[model samples]
Target: MAFPRSTCLLLLLASFLLTPLEGHTFNVMDYGAIGNGRTDDSEAFMKAWSDVCKASASPTFLVPGDRRFLINPVVFEGRCRSKKIKFKVDGTITAPSEPSKWKCINKQCHSWISFKHVDGLVISGSGTIDGNAEKWWKQGRVTGARPNALVVARSNNVQLHDLSFKDNPHMHVVFHHCDGVKISHISIDAPEDSPNTDGIHLKETASVIIEHCTIGTGDDCISLVDGSTHIDMRHIKCGPGHGISIGSLGKFGLSETVEYIHVKDAQFTGTTNGVRIKTWQGGRGHARNMIFEKIRSSDSEYPIIIDQFYCDHTECHDKPNAVEIRNISYIDVKGTSKKETAVKIACSDTVPCRDIFIQNINLIYDQSGKQASAYCKNVINGYYHGVVRPNISCLQNDKLP
Candidate 1:
């Protein structure tokens, strides 16, 4: 059989086009990204993400092991074609040490790596995201101009595990407006004096579960802000930071609500506070149906505190409206408090906290040798059980004056 050259070429092209498209692994090194730790690999990363984002099948974007990648501020934004994508970071990702080089003009630019509008994204790696923050810390001012190591915003069905973040300039990881996020087996470390270096911060997010994580940072180990709901945290070890907190919320005097939060089986060592809920004096909304149980604290201050009048500066004055807090419970919380007053429930006089329950709580001051005490005001329907310190006499008999 003799075939003409043009006909043979057409048949070959048809055969190639009919072949099935296979999944690919886009390596950053293949796209002109030198993993020498000094060269800027931002463009390579962007190109890799673009290729993987358009993959028809589930593909992997890999950062190979044993190499260090220096990436400036980059955003991996997507309405990706793939239904699922895997990002395997097997090497170190380092940020620029100099703050001036960051050139961050606004808050959005203050993130080293950001993922937006990504769905079904799995980020797991045995690698490190190093935010060489010692130089920024020396500048001595915690500003929004500094970049956070990672930010996952407007994303859904995200799972991040087995990763490490160190020396972050700001909060290590932030989940903003994200849903169905699960994070486990992660480690975050920062100096105790690294200002505003919160470990994990959630805002406007829902259905998040964070477990089996060890976090040590300067600010709150875990902070849930406005519009966050159904958050569960378990088996977390926190140290040298402000402990788990909710509702440093409504700061702008806006209407905000945080509900259905449960934090159990957690331990805090040398933290400033444990299981705290703080809100500004003039705010609207509610913090309800929250539980903190089986918490073991060591050398912590204000082991259980609800401050409706949370003003950080001297110029802030008391306001009338406050966030309504109700149906909150703290059970089996035993700790050594650094302050003499272990329990302070300073609720708002206007709205007042209701349906508060405390059980099996035993907090003792370590150094003072004085017994820990409880202070309550403008609270009602309070119940105490099993060795309550400082005597919840003020809250006895549902008394409201």
Candidate 2:
């Protein structure tokens, strides 16, 4: 008996255009952020990431939990308006423990928390990003150029999980040119003589999916340089790091490229190199389809390397076109080698190393009964199947020049 009045304002504008529109947290202590671990919350996290990147719904940028901010070289910019931006971080994100209180940005000191051009980003909670890098590692590892602790540039579908990284003044979480990334259960620690502390690095990233990580760094617990491709790592737990590398790629000679990499169920203890692939000498391109399966190496030290003459110094000269390694595989790698060789395929005497595959390798020699060996130079098309224990004999005669 009382309808009219423009039919009750057209039923309240169709119930406010079918509801659903509230999700824009943006709390960095309400934009003035005084989480206190020595103050500088970087302009309250860039004004709460500018209202969580201008929120258009799926927003959230919080940083709550047991406080400890103090960030300095920040950057969090993005072409956002929210396509799912959640960066929660339960709290603790230090850095700037002196190397002159570190702050460079344009004059370089590269990354101390940068996530530019984000897309569908989602960094998880139970945080801890620390990097109070012990005075930049006593300042002098080539003058400690420092600063790399979280940098996800040109992002795509990124998603990092349950974070925790520490004492890193160099590489600890870097994913450049990202696309479809997903890092899981993260945990990285430094100080095994922390210098380049790389825990999880990847350049020109694509379709990445790292899982259950637990890295202990001093370098590469997982590094895939140059245009990294479809990478997939599993249950990793590397140690005093250096295991898991794929190219010190095409360095002074550029033209690099890394291919579909897959590492499985990894676990390396005192690592120094357990599954490597360091390229150097006048680089060219191509690090083909790779896979290092079910690896478990304790007391590692070159438990299976493929150094394309990766000279870290001594005025590296000998250049003759390297970086062409082909379809590589090393399945079920079991080990305990503090070095008695333990499989070192130093390929590239003019780009050698084609199909190189080795099956169930069991390396020994961690003292108690010495026995572990296998070293091949310029690997020329190798392939050995089934039980290969200290017996790679140049990959068993699959010779191809």
Candidate 3:
């Protein structure tokens, strides 16, 4: 009843001809130890990187241990793309207090670690990259030229794991114009008082996943800026920072449509706010299909918020910025806060915020709840439960002076 071998040749060939996966393995070595927590091991780190992730070599890179490393931001130029570029750092990479004194990539961004115009690079380590950012952060109060810890730009298929990056003068990690990024099992810590020290800044990216991470800083644990889509975050712990956020968008002539995003199984402690979606009245874009589920918070500000007229600065921008936010659902969110209200929904006038839903949220907003000062148009189908008050008080309760 079956065909003979020669007769079924084409079918057999088809079965054997599935698309093969092209991937490479590389390694890096800091030539640095992990215990001391202070050393300049970047040069050796670069040497280890050069040995492994060469132009024609395998993609995965490993970083071995047993020494001290003081490294500056390694410079990577040109359009570098291969199966994958992996950095296995089992040691420590230390950033100097003065970045200018350290080895720099292009002199534009002072990062302890950086990559530019790369494709499919996976940077992971069971070790630590120490920013030691307190002095720099304190100096930034006067200079205001603080630098980020890790910077990746114009890349794709990026993965970071088993890594601890901390003490950033500015943002701890930044992904710019990079798509397909994944961050897992990473820990970031900075002073809760540091300014602009965001945990992760994902800008102009598509299809990003942040999971199993613990972040504590001064700004948003995750800040999604202009031109991002398909972002998924889960199983995260954040504290003393702005919670996971979407937009202060549409300021730079950008109109992003964020969808298919989910944030769940997250816990927050003593953060300024919990979950927020903020947009300016001047941005022109649409946001749909966002879900926040199974998130818990304690001693937090606004547990849920949607601010369409969001501008923290006075001279905001001169753009036709507006956003259409709809079809957003926040379910199974429980939190205990002493704020005035648990939810705040402030939309824009030209384009309203509608179809926002909240169910099974057990938020405890006391009279001391915080609210946003930014005001805009009214929202439709905006729902809430266990929230005290809104549209009356700005974010004065948690406002820092």
Query: What is residue 269's positional error in candidate 3, in angstroms?
Result: 0.9
Error of 3 at 139 (Å): 2.4
**Model 1 worst lDDT window (10 residues):** 392-401
Best by lDDT: 1
Candidates 1 and 3 compared by lDDT, better number: 1
Error of 2 at 331 (Å): 14
At residue 18, candidate 3 shows an lDDT of: 50
> Which runs in model 2 stand beyond 4 Å of their true positions?
1-25, 39-57, 62-85, 88-92, 95-121, 124-128, 131-158, 161-192, 195-216, 223-241, 245-271, 274-342, 345-394, 399-401
lDDT per residue as tens, model 3, 211-286: 9999999899988876777889999999989888887776555666666678989888888778888877667777
1-401: candidate 2 lDDT, tens digit per residue: 99999999999998866643448588899888899799788888998888778767788888998999988888888898768889988999897688677667776787888988989999999989998888788775666477888999988998999989999788989988888999999899998888888899899989999999999988888999999999999998999888889979988898899999999989899988888988897889989999989898988988788888887777888888887989898888886889888788878767788888888788897856677888786666678877788887777734434
Candidate 1 Cα errors over 4 Å, as ranges: 1-23, 103-108, 140-144, 367-370, 397-401
- Candidate 3 residues lying further than 4 Å off, grouped into runs, are 1-40, 55-60, 78-82, 103-106, 141-144, 252-257, 314-321, 366-377, 383-401
lDDT-best of 2 and 3 = 2
TM-score between model 3 and native: 0.79
Question: Model 1 over residues 351-387: C-alpha lDDT tens digits?
Answer: 9999998877888887655678888888888887666
All-Cα superposition RMSD per candidate: 4.1, 16.8, 8.5
Backbone clash pairs for candidate 2 read none
In model 3, state the lDDT of residue 167.
80
